[model samples]
Target: MDTQPNIRSYVIDLADQLGIRYQATPEDALADIATRLAGDEVVIDEIEDLLVALKRTGAINGNEMVTLLGQYLDEKFSER
Candidate 1:
């Protein structure tokens, strides 16, 4: 079973590819997601929409996008 931070590897890698600087720490990626999801509640549809947008824009591949979505859901639901 993969941990939540580990599951965000693709996103952090993508950020690195884009030359975006973030904290050199384990929680940075999760923090990034929280920052993005801040103004509103994050729901499954939003996650799906994000996945579609990322895939449509060639930002993330299919399998990994699914994995990311699953991980995101796990993190979200696990917090409840």
Candidate 2:
């Protein structure tokens, strides 16, 4: 599980790698989708692109990413 700060920081770092300026808050990052993704509103394509880059670079796998995100989300909502 990732803490709010961790998730926020990680996403920001990913954005940096993708050459995208993600100056949003952690909550914003949670809601924001792939910037380069197609579709009218969903940025899933962007996410896929990022995933590919991460995979190629051996940065992080999709499973690890999901686990961290899930942990973060659980911790966040648990507080509510």
Best candidate according to TM-score: 1
Single out the weakest 10-residue window by summed lDDT for candidate 1.
Answer: 19-28
Q: Considering only N, C-alpha and C atoms within 3 Å, which residue pairs clash in candidate 1?
A: none
C-alpha lDDT of all candidate models, in order: 0.59, 0.54
lDDT tens readout by residue for model 2, 4-74: 57554565577576665323356545556443243346434334444445554557677866775566566
Which lDDT tens digits does candidate 1 get at residues 1-80? Answer: 75545434555555557554432344645765886778654434444454555665667789878888888678667879
Candidate 2's TM-score: 0.34
Clashing pairs in 2: 37-46
